[model samples]
Target: MFLTKIDTLGNVVFSRLLGSATNAEAFSLAVDSQDNVIIAGSTTDNLGDNTRISGTDSFVTKFSARGDRIFTYQLDTVAQDKPAAIAIDADDNIILTGFSDGAINAATPSNGGRDVMLLKIDGDSGQRIDEALIGSATTERGEAVAIAEDGNILLASIDNGRAVLRKVDVNDFSNILFEQDLGQINNSGAISGLRVSGSNIFLAGSTSNSGFTGTAASIAKDFAGDTDGFVLKLTDNGSSADADFVSFVGTEAFDKINDIAVGASSVFVVGSTRGALEAGGREGPTDAFITRIDMATGAIEQVQQFGLLLTNNEATGIAFTNTGPSVLDALGLPAGTVDRIETRSVDSQTTAKAGDYFDISIDGGRKRRITLNEGDTFSDIARRINRLSFRGDVSADGSNGKLVIRANGSASVDLIAGEGSSDLLGKLGLKSQRLLGTDALFNLNDDDDQNSSSTESDLGGVFAFKLDGPLGLQDRQTAAFTLTQIQEAINTSQRAFRSLSPSILDTLGDQLGGSASGVVPTRLQSQLANYSAALSRLQSGSGGGGFFI
Candidate 1:
């Protein structure tokens, strides 16, 4: 894979060129599941022999896991333009997006100046389906394209001073959905760069007006700056869906934005500017600025500025990977440095290395744990973490951070401190945890503490924790007890059930039905009784920490 390492001294340590840089050929990049690099742009010449096409053509290169070029494929069309952007889909389909000059009579008269072209090629065979003339030909130039979950191709371009966003059928390349303008731009608007998250579209361009505009809807026709840099949010269909002032503007005059990329929670835009915050938030000077904006609210974040003194350093393409921090750590770069990757494997897994003293799986196969604290209302965890699996109880130490993990092949699960709150839950879906108990629990699974991940949707989660693993779930309406409390419950229940002939409800009258109908009835009565008896014996004399053993 072609790797570019930028050190703290602003020196690009290693810009290794992979495969053959065919003369006149440009390579667009993406990462595969195994972190392999895949480059798909256009190749004009073979082995620097000669330009293969009248205009820039299509080229794809495959790289080994260790940055070695494995294969190269060149594709071409009679079009006069060149490939612009390339991205990989969920199925590893390499999407080549660019503009074409020659008219594809098969499509239309072509978008006046340039027609948006999309080519989907099999990553392995280089087999491709050409999608030429995607949008209006009125100076329409495709800047980006992405493959959606439904196998539809989302294309973004600029035409007639408007950002045209649309989804085309993957098979026929027909417009499945589309919209017109993204930002409330002046009549002189033109989309230059584009990015995507799922089906959401992010576009950057410039707009100018000679007439008056309205401020009621925040749409200002006559912007403050001359061709200010603006970042816009678009939907699957390119429409003016954001607030009029939603697009952040730059300060410098004649600022034409180049590329846009999205990070963890930040939206990055790079272009010309003299450190001004127009409708598009603030920007660095003409020194090729990279500004981060909040993904949810579109608010600009004031962070470190790179290349503030460079004369002509222009930020072109952008990509991000999870190991960016680790790369920084290895390179001794400052924290918060971002790394852009090309293509990855089909089943690429993200994981953290296991540290000593705690059980946090470094690989993607590890399980998840939900910690608890004192005064943690059972409903608190249930409401916060979706699919809350409360199998264990609070810690013996006063720290309430206990956990209920799935059985890990054993009959017990333990909770300790020092586990990071955020990173530990990185792989977890937002609000995917739920509460399984009001306190400590167990005995519904294989009768063990070795909690492992149970992916079965129904058989997994806290809701699956039944009192007997066959009957109803255990009742936990009190404080979250610890492992000791749970072990005691197991002992008490087993003894009672074993002696009472496996409970017909009549046998568990005191535990299941209790003596009467009340809050302390049924399950609570049994638990309270067992708890009292266990406490008396444990706190007797030499029961250190209430006999943890």
Candidate 2:
């Protein structure tokens, strides 16, 4: 781990590297009133202490403003202990929160699996003052910590997939003043950022529940899609708390808020998004975004996205400095570097033709036919799909000009081509596909790299059929009837491309340099050439009675 201090002009004042031969990671850091920097995290190395505990041990180290080490305190434990967040109290006391598999400093015994661990340490002496463990029989993680106005500890935690908040008395670690479950039952959510301003408490996290309704009016009352980042405000009324508002922001792809900072009048949030979150389209597959929202009305004020094209970028931390909000990102670019992007605006055109129809089934149950009328829009089609008794919901995405169908209540959805005179699936650019309610096609599965053999086999099988089927180029008479089949094939290829894991994609891109270098594998190159020739033939008037290579 390395720590560096920079002056107002971005010049390095002092830098220090803190670690041992083994691995050490710093998760959270804070600055005291006296200009002392404190860092807390977990480490596998003993760090010159020569006392090695079992698994990973959590430690806190403090350094003076002049870059001199003050004290290093490590919590001895027989199991893994990791601190996720750290905060300084009024008297410069250290408050740490994280997860532990066992007790720390012999304060509280572990309930069962990993539990939320809270500890208080003296600022000067670096000694433990109080400790407490909060959890049930299941796993609970302490994600963030903050100090309330009343000198209490406010902890944001995830308890069995639910977001939870607790206010604990600082003097007595075990004394919980107030507690609340922020998420609905059976829904998964996490709270990563917490802040207290006067009587208002702000929490930022991500939730996967579509029914996560806010108590007060919000800019987006409905969940956007996939995992959405949310900012919730609550007013602490001494004894109890009341929710002021909860605003959710996201796209049809994964979006999460890693950290939040409160300014004079606006709430600033930084995170990563896979879809377009603002007027400007997505910079790449994933881009870091900083959004400012109205503190009182919960309205979005401004949003800025920054990243390199065709690369993933994420912003993990944000803090309000004298200059403005200082954001920490994984872009790996130099400070003040900007990339100019050209954006094109296209109006939403009607794609649904009159008398077009498709078939839908839920969990392989009875098939339902949906037919469109004259002047029907995508929203109309979504309404028609929702009117049925299928255990799913469909929405028309205006930004991407596509239809999104999601199964609900542990259901699966299947879209099939309608029979004669009602075939609209091809025109919609969707093959007969079945997807689970939880399947996110664009999400990069980490295990895909480990199981690349099977994944490659499955993808090859999918493309093999796609290349020889009736809509494929091999069937020239049927495929050349219209360009919809070719568009469907292109959509299938895009899906296949997105299905590959990031690691695999990176490896392939590095090895072959993609089609731009003309270094693609022989089989893949032949397939691309076939598609190009077929498209050319279809465009010209000589597409009759010719077999595509």
Candidate 3:
């Protein structure tokens, strides 16, 4: 039961040797961008072909960027114990969690039983970096660990007769970032798995909740037809709700969660479901289920239930790759979920004019693009801008003198030179670029509507914008400006991005920290993190692999 990597062809690239006939169980795994695998789980048997630890001990292993075993170490306290899960950070640091026997020996402990414990090590040599035992003296169980981008670690445990969560610093491991209890009414249920994405933490396990004692808006669901697989999501702050607290239940009477994996924008759960289902053309029997949740809104995008009478009995472990939709589909996500990312750039060009004339068009009511031409007095543009901007949405100023334009109601935007800026058209081809970009992305969903039957759509709701200026000045032409101001504005408005960057980092860190079972997700997260870290470093002159890749 040790953590190991299997190639697409299914071969164990890593299988650590255990002591005396006792086997090693790899409870968790993470793979970094460098392709190195980090595994953690307690070892009841002595390991290493030669000398083994005298008693059951916790262990962490590291592999080279090439997947070769680099180092291994046994971690034990005065109390007897084992780690249940482990993770890695952007800097290749390791985090191992699970229960400790409440021991505190120098090298190895005398031994107690199971109290929540944490051990962080360098991915290069498996050396301890920081250690902490969460909870007050009483027994606690930790099944997962996640490190935020700023180097904060989030640990999930079963404490005080319920699931508890904690946030700790990665550097000195001293200050507690935050801590709170997860809604765990069950007596002593296990928090089997934990993975963070953005600011959200996804937890999966089975709970005995026959009585409906959850908070408001919490729906009580009976599993299959009767043992529900419970999945809970928490915020980085460890609160019950307030933008955190996402929960999902399986309807099949026999479904129970085995584990969970966190991705950039989604969470995956592998579990079992029994009773009537709508998979493989059948409506009855047991099936392995893989459910994908949109991490942003905790929305259940798709459900994939397999194995009616063949294939794997139940979904065991769910993993994701940067490859094809088939694999993503296997995880129960809608096929196109991973494909829209081909490019998410938006191009919007607003018409500009020194005169006091303004025009804003809402195609199908969802797509709005503004147009301002000659006669567009400062007041006209301002009025249109004001109308477009609701009180709650953020807006940017694109007007100076009588030349004006900007965005309303959207934090995410490509407010380059909205449709028509003379200076933008001169200094850079921003206007044309906007046109080309619009043509590329302005897809409409008119395909479903008889009126839009002549429209386009792999996924409808697309539109295109044609501004005034060159096409007609007083012909709607007059104003002009540089794209630099727009870029500056965007750069300024986007500073708030860092506001949400930490959660993204923590979730990414967890994915890259492969414990043992598999390195697939870790490798994916590492590649993304390194890509992000490299970009960040490059911007700060730190160094990087370059954009040539």
The candidate that achieves the highest TM-score relative to the unseen native structure: 2
Clashes of each: 56, 0, 68
| Model 2, residue 99: C-alpha shift (Å) | 0.6
Expressed as tens digits, the lDDT of each residue in 20-93 for candidate 2 is 34578999999999888999988875532335564688899887776666667888778788999999999999
Please identify model 3 stretches exceeding 4 Å from their true place: 1-21, 48-53, 65-67, 106-113, 185-188, 210-226, 237-245, 263-265, 277-286, 308-312, 325-549
Query: Could you give the C-alpha RMSD of every candidate to the true structure, in order shown?
Result: 28.7, 30.3, 34.6
List where candidate 2 sits over 4 angstroms from the true fold. Answer: 48-50, 105-107, 185-188, 214-221, 323-549
For candidate 1, write residues 424-543 as lDDT tens digits: 233221223322322123333343643322222213113222233222224342222334345545554444444545445656786655665556657777999999988887667573
Task: Pull out the clashing pairs in model 2.
Answer: none
Location of the lowest summed lDDT over 10 successive residues in candidate 2: 342-351
Indicate whether candidate 1 or candidate 2 has the larger lDDT: 2
Question: Stretches of candidate 1 above 4 Å error?
Answer: 1-22, 25-27, 47-55, 103-113, 135-137, 149-151, 183-192, 209-223, 235-245, 275-285, 303-310, 324-549
Alpha-carbon deviation at 256 in model 2, angstroms: 0.8
Error (Å) of candidate 3 at residue 262 is 4.0
Kindly list the per-residue Cα lDDT of model 3 for residues 1-549, writing each as its tens digit. Answer: 434445443544434332213445667777776777776755554433232345667777665543345566676444566777777777878888877665544643323335678787877766677776665655577777777545578787777567666777777665777776665546545566777666666667776664422232443233343456666665554433232434555663556778888877777887877743344542336677777777666567777776645543776677776565466446554432222211111110121222212133322134344444433344544555556646523233434433333333223333333322223222112331221122223223233432222222212222222232232123111222123223333443343343334456567768867344554567778899889987776577625655433
Best by lDDT: 2
